[model samples]
Target: MESVKLFGTWFSPYSRRVEMALKLKGVEYEYIEEDLKNKSPDLLKYNPVHKKVPLLIHNGKPISESLLILEYIDETWPGPAILPSDPYERSMARFWAKFLDEKCPPAMTRACMRTGEEQEKAYEEAIEVLTFLENELIGKKFFGGDTIGLVDITANLIAHWHRFFEEFSEIMQPPLITKEKFPNICEWVNDYTNCSFVQENLPEKDKLAQLYKARIQAAKAATQ
Candidate 1:
């Protein structure tokens, strides 16, 4: 097997998603922590276009972007596939994963950063996105049915980071996804987080919260 290396920050969901995929596949890899504030030359050299963390370097070849890296890992390693085997199921998984990739980040990022009317608008937008996911998850234990798959992986932010948003953000209305309101999604969160690999790989919540709090303060300062 070729050498695998991941450049990522501890607190990033994108990085965690890749880490989980590699763990699920039982692939051994080197983990390199990158500071987003002062990015290293390797990160810039490997992913000059995006200049982002979670870049997977395989056999000295670098792959950037979390979703794309996940696909690469799934293809390269192949055991306990993160994506389904059936072509149609794989297509559906890809669709929803891409949808969430486009939709979830902006809505939730805003919800995390702003505290006033702007935060309300972001919460509304996030609700719409989560509601769509909630309905899709109806009658299903996981987004990929019985087992966690691509869509489930893509929705990792909701399962883990969202609660922190509720705790940190001032404009809390609906309250971070509850079983009463989004039963399937709530159930999915439990199932996903309880998975042994995910449990083992997750970062400490207190540290993550503190990191995010500083980020939110910085974002607020930039606006003022």
Candidate 2:
């Protein structure tokens, strides 16, 4: 077996996505924590295009982009599949993942940087995205249906970050997503968090809250 190594930052949800997938599939690999602001030469060389963490290096080959690396990991390791087996279902899963990577961070960024009109607009947009997710869970336990697959992992990590955004973006008026408001997703979060691998790995929520609060304040100060 070739050696597998992962470069990631603890706070990034993008990094967490790959972490969850690897654990779920029971892949053994070494993790290299990177200081993204002061990126290492190795990370820069491996992911020169993005210069981002969550780069997966298998044997002598390097794969960048979280979703692409995830698909590669799934392809390489054929146990406990992350994507759907059916072609149509797989397309839907990819669609949701793409939507998430494209849309989510900006919503959080907009909410953090401005207030009044801008902040409200950001909140509205964020809720629309969250609403799509909440409604998608009407009958299905997970995003790609009953089994926890790619889409579920992609979106739930955002919902996790929303916990931080709530405090960081005090102006945020998030739509119904709590245990009382959206019971299925609430239970889904609990289920995912309770899974031994997720429980053992992933960032601690309390620390995330503090980091987000400070980071939001920094963004606010920078823009002002």
Cα-based TM-score, every candidate: 0.92, 0.91
lDDT (10s digit) by residue, model 2, range 8-43 = 988888888888888888999999999977999999
- The whole-model lDDT of each prediction reads 0.86, 0.78
Clashing residue pairs in candidate 2 (N, C-alpha, C atoms within 3 angstroms): none
TM-score of 2: 0.91
Highest-lDDT candidate: 1
What clash pairs does model 1 have?
Answer: none
C-alpha displacement of 147 in model 1, angstroms? 1.0
lDDT per residue (tens digit) for residues 121-205 in model 1: 8888888988999989888988989888878887888888778766766556658477887787888899999999888767789
What lDDT score goes with residue 128 in model 2?
76
